[model samples]
Target chain A: MSVTAAFPSRARAWLRGLLAGPLALLTALLTMMGGALWLPEGAAGLDHLVVPVVFFPMLWAGWFLYACLDPRLLRGFAVVGGAALLQLGLILVHLMAAKGAVT
Target chain B: MIKLPKQQTQSLLAVHGWSGVLLGLLLYAVICTGVAAVFAKEISDWSSPLSRPSGQELPTGFDAAYRDLARQVDPLFLHEVFLFPTAGGRWNVLFHVDEKDAKGQPVERGTEFELDPKTLKPLARRDGLLDEIADQRRSNAVADFLVDLHVRLHLPNPWGLLLTGTLGLMMMVAAVSGLFLHRHLFKEIFTLRRRGGLLTARDVHVVAGAWNLPFAFLLAFTGSFFSFATTIGVPAMAMVAFNGDIEAATAALTAKKLPEDPSPVTPANLDALFADARQRGGARVGFVSLEHWGRADARATVQLEAREGGLLNTAYLYSLASGEFIREQPFLGHVPSTGNSLVLLMSPLHFGNFAGVVSKSVWFALGFAGAYVTLTGMLLWTRRRQEQRSWRIMDRAVHLVGYGLPLALAVAPYAYFLLRDRGPHPADTQGVLFLAVAATLIVCAAVADDLTRYRRRLLAATGVALAGLPLARLASGGIGWSAAWQQGLASLLAVELALFVAGALYLRLALRRSATDEATPAAGPAMQA
Candidate 1:
């Protein structure tokens, strides 16, 4: 491989690693925090809180593994970033509703 | 085995190695202490035993003793009360009220009575804030030291919990990526090459890692859940649901609800309620908590030990005013559900206390192996890069922590025994001693010429320290072996004997390592990668 060709490849690899490492972690955290709001409470009314807390590790692990194994870096970013944004939106919506109710 | 694309497999291999290399030392520390802490209850009993076993955690006259103590406690702090067995089979009765401190932080100011279960007489009394009173408990100092190290590495508040939780996640990542990287998993499980250097070491690492992969994953998942659930999950949920009111969030999850009826009314006979709970649950009661005692809405909750071969225990609720039995409920919620069941399962799966001593022994061995794999994995990584100056520094660190942590842990109990009766704050003294030993080890690691020699010497010191523990205990007014035997304190004697045997084994290994001339570099040039 020529040096010129390898430079671009190396840069791309660095970018992919960043996305898969820290960005993936942020995505998992956002999803967990927001997913709790949308998840349905079971008959006992505690599932929404208890289930997410108990399975947070698996949630993060799945996202982390997926971020690493995905062949296309762009797709990984799109999927992870999209999920994060969706959850963030849900959280904002809930906060807005709560504020309105308080007012 | 599952097959993956070549590129994907390589990616996972990098993930596995980097994850292990990054947090491997801290994870090893956690696992090592955790293995010892699996028998923390036994350690407490062995270190500080009553004249007799007390035979039961909560004795028959507990109700009377509790009532007497309740009469003496100030009514201002009687909003809640708890009765549980503490170290050395002593029953602790705590009456407290949650009040905001000067900084507006919620804290429990309470009175605690340590009563001898056999005699139903108060052995000690403490009145202060809950945290301050907790610091004065010296009987369980040794076990608490080990558990605190394992759970949080002695870091304060959420930081220690956060670090251990992150280590748990790192272990999970390593386990998952390892599963993917090893294509011939079953074939490697039985393979151990007889080569004398890195080949043999790599083989051992692979075999042990392969065999422990599932258990490692299970423990990591459950352990992280326990750490994060308190530090992050509850508060985050509270923020979203209760506008950051933790108390309200806890009440919702715990299913605590009562109509406001604080009218003065004497509570009914707690003895009858205790017997009813035991009869209904078909298990021994482990803990009892009464809310709003001596009030019209007083409620008592009794937690029971799980029955033989059962995974879950029943918690009975009673109306203390009428002495009527309420419905039995699960630990977390008012009714049995999947979420409650999963949360309940996490304790036994992580602690391995589901089946008593047998299960605990298995967990201890497996946890020890997990710790071994972590140490060797780091050593292999560092040894492969030992030529680089930075990597050489890391190599020294790996050796220091790998051998020095066990030495520090072995030294802590000595401090506990020596300072327990002589001081008011033995736990603090023990902590300081632990840090001093660790610092000394680090300095020794820096000065030593041969890393291998340093490891051996440290191991031998640990062995000597462990062997001397029982003598120290006996010298410090503990029960002698003959007395322990006559009193049927078999568990205490067994722990003493086990520590002696373990010490002897470590000494033997260290001596054998000293006799060997194969102190060659950990990994050969070809293995460097």
Candidate 2:
């Protein structure tokens, strides 16, 4: 195979690797953070905090497996990247709103 | 059971093999130590017990002991006090106040006293930080040594937790991928072949791995949760929710706030509260915490062992000033909820202390099998590639660690027993001896040409060390079997017998293997390696 033909396949593999490794980790953590925001605070006022921690392993595994087994590399990147961005946006917005209220 | 395309299956196989090969030794170490750690309480009792068996965890005069100790401590430390039984039922009472250290770090500083269970008199006293108190403890050295290694590998916090957490994830990857890699999972569960060489080794690994899949997943999942909960989960949650105040986050999740009443009042008798908690919870009191001592808002939380035929422990709250029952406390929340229930399940599911000795025995056997699967998996991986020099050396290393770790663990307690009084602190001695044994094994692995002989020698040494432990204990003032039986010290007798039986079995296996291998020089794949 020519070098030009190999470059695209190599780039695709690297992107997939990035998605499966760091991006998957980022998504899992953000989901855990976002869970506390959206989930209900139960009678003890700690459900949101405790539930996400208990299921943290499963959350990470689900994201990691999806990143590895997805056939469409582009689709894999889109989903993981999308989840991370969404959670980050949610957290940032919540922080900004709290800061505004404090001011 | 689960079908996938050929390419995906190949990917799964690659993942499984790589994960196991990369972290299998550390994972094996953790699992092996954990098998022993399942009996940590019993081992502590066996290694360092009082002359007679303990009467009750919380005896009648516990109130007098508390009051006498409280008089010696600073009044500020009366903000919180923790009372529990440890180190063969020696009563430990800590009067502490949560405050910032000189370095501006949050810490609990306190005066701690260890009291004799029978006489209710102080055996030892220390005034300092809680962490320092823990580090200075010598009575439970052997059990603490083994439990610490399993929990954190004895490295510093956060980093040790991170490494073990990552290992837990690697274990989960191997377990999950193994599920996909085996096409005939149910068949393989009963398919151990008696044929010789690499094929037979492969069959044994598969059968053991197949039967232990669910257990491995459960252990790995729960183990990872524990390792990561404080390291990653707590920090991340605190950052978002409490503006990076980990202390505040922890307080919110754990403590139930009561309205402040600063008026001083005479504190109620702790013995009455203990008896009430035991009766109401239908279990023995295991631990007690007093908050705001001698004040109207004072409260006590008494954590009890699991009730009869139950899986989770129950803690009851009480008004310390009034001596009235407040409520049964949930693990995480003020009221029982889904989150609290899930958090409660984690301990019994991970430690297997829910149903007492029977449950612990089951967990120990399954954990032992998990360790076996990991060791065999590594051996088979390296054995297949022994043509390469690196892989051949790896085969030696696998044998070295796989067999050497148990040998080192077995030998560590001898230092604990011998050095408990005359020499250095037994905790430090245990660590030094453990490293010495490991280093010696490493040297042997490096110099020895015959891998099989090295393994057998390690096994024999382990057996001898184990069998001789009871003698060391006896020499260091441990009770003998007849006295133990008469005094109803079943834990001591049981542990002694178990160690002897296990040691004899190991010696028998080693002798039998030496004989069989001498007869046929190149009979098995392990010998070939």
Candidate 3:
């Protein structure tokens, strides 16, 4: 575990961290976009739920991941990350109860 | 083509160059004047004598004064007009009387009267400070010219929107590419070393562009969104999803789904609703919407939400009539989880109209910075290929449009203030001012250029026109600039003074540069080439 040896790995890690941000936002954008053909069928209620049910949770999760991936932004970002997953889970449950497509 | 080791910088330069040229001249007008437009209301008030009194009224009986506003407003228009307890509300209230024409909605004539809220009397108005030099009535003439210019570079509407929208995309692409190209994202943060002439200018473009990338992104994104909402977004959304159901799509985007049921009889008192909203909101009731204003299902809901401390945030709305409070549906805040929240945050983020004075100021500063980034990029673009054969024509076009733009902006406020006294209505004043400024810009674009022979003449003409603004003020018998100032005409005075100062500086620099460039053959080749 020489400091000199660790330097290359640290640089690799930092590079990886920087790339993660854009990747997260991209993933979120894709997930939201993926719901294009996802117009709720029989129940008109599903329509109201489209943005709230599908779009937001992905965006939140993406932003959360984006935040946490930054080492300097690590401290509170982890809590936000955990909350992001929690929110996603809760949103999924809400969507299911509302009879979303995934359900 | 010159090759450089930094592939990314070249890419960024290309992106920056294209985007800048594509939208620069027009956006410069928008930014140059928007620097003043941020304080538009103040500038208007300052330039227009009709809005205020000769002296500030004591606040001792302010509530009584506000109540008096009821008398002046025809009960129907009251909903449209609000009296500021102070000078700082969004806009001043004057009853704009609408005269009906044949088979159409009543045409709004002009501001008929300034209602003294305390007395409810239409005050005997004169063009105060704003008009002492420039017309307050046409204040937006200054801003609107820039806005129209920015969004569409004085091109026709469709063309303007298309160009600006393209520029917006360019801006976004530039930002992304810029971020990608900068390997040392923060290491070069303090790398600005101001050098001679072009290099100094280049450094400025780089530092400002890099440091303000986020702000640039947000401003451009919002700007593009704004222009696109009308030009592209609404149309695209309508065609693709709703089969040109613009109204339905707009309703979804704007209005929270309200019930068809009426809430007339037992509906709560509208006045009481505001008090209740304020009580709930604590700080201020930012928005109030009535579900069924005169109907029974009208549950006046008010939000007791907190200030959104970060981006993509806002949450607060109240019932207009019943003083009943409502929760936001969901999905509004940066932390959107509901419908109510979704709608609430839209405006704040879109307009950057929230978060107190500091936020608005920051938005204003960044907005102009975004505008500068666009302008400097245009200069760099023209300068980059100055040695090429065809570039002379292009350079002339860019510079002609560039320098003349700020002149257009300077002329607009003057147009506004100058025409204010003569126009019967505010609308007429606005119309006259806009027509004058736009006509001038087109004419300038047509005749003006950056010819080495005609350089002094062109700059001198622009400078003279700018300097004439002060003379125009005095010639109009400005109720005396001193009198205008004494009458609490600070806004009018301040803006006019700034305009004059800018005009003087422009004249000085233009004259000096023209003379200096003419004297030295060595400097001549460099500048011209």
TM-score of 3: 0.62
Best by DockQ: 2
Docking class of 2: medium
Error of 3 at B277 (Å): 2.7
| Model 3 chain B: lowest-lDDT 10 consecutive positions | B125-134
- Stretches off by above 4 angstroms in model 1 are A1-14, B196-199, B514-529
Show where candidate 3 strays beyond 4 Å: A1-103, B1-13, B49-142, B151-162, B181-189, B192-199, B234-244, B253-269, B282-293, B297-322, B328-361, B421-497, B511-529
Model 1 / residue A93 / CA error / Å: 1.9
State how far residue B158 of model 2 sits from its true place (Å): 0.6
- Model 3: per-residue Cα lDDT over B163-237, one tens digit each: 665465556656655665665657655676633333355566667777888866655555555555465444533
User: Model 2's DockQ?
Assistant: 0.71
Error of 1 at B453 (Å): 1.2
B210-263, model 1: which lDDT tens digit per residue?
A: 999999999999999988999988888888778888888888888656576899
- Model 3 CA lDDT for position B508: 73
User: What CAPRI class is candidate 3?
Assistant: incorrect
Better of 2 and 3 by TM-score: 2
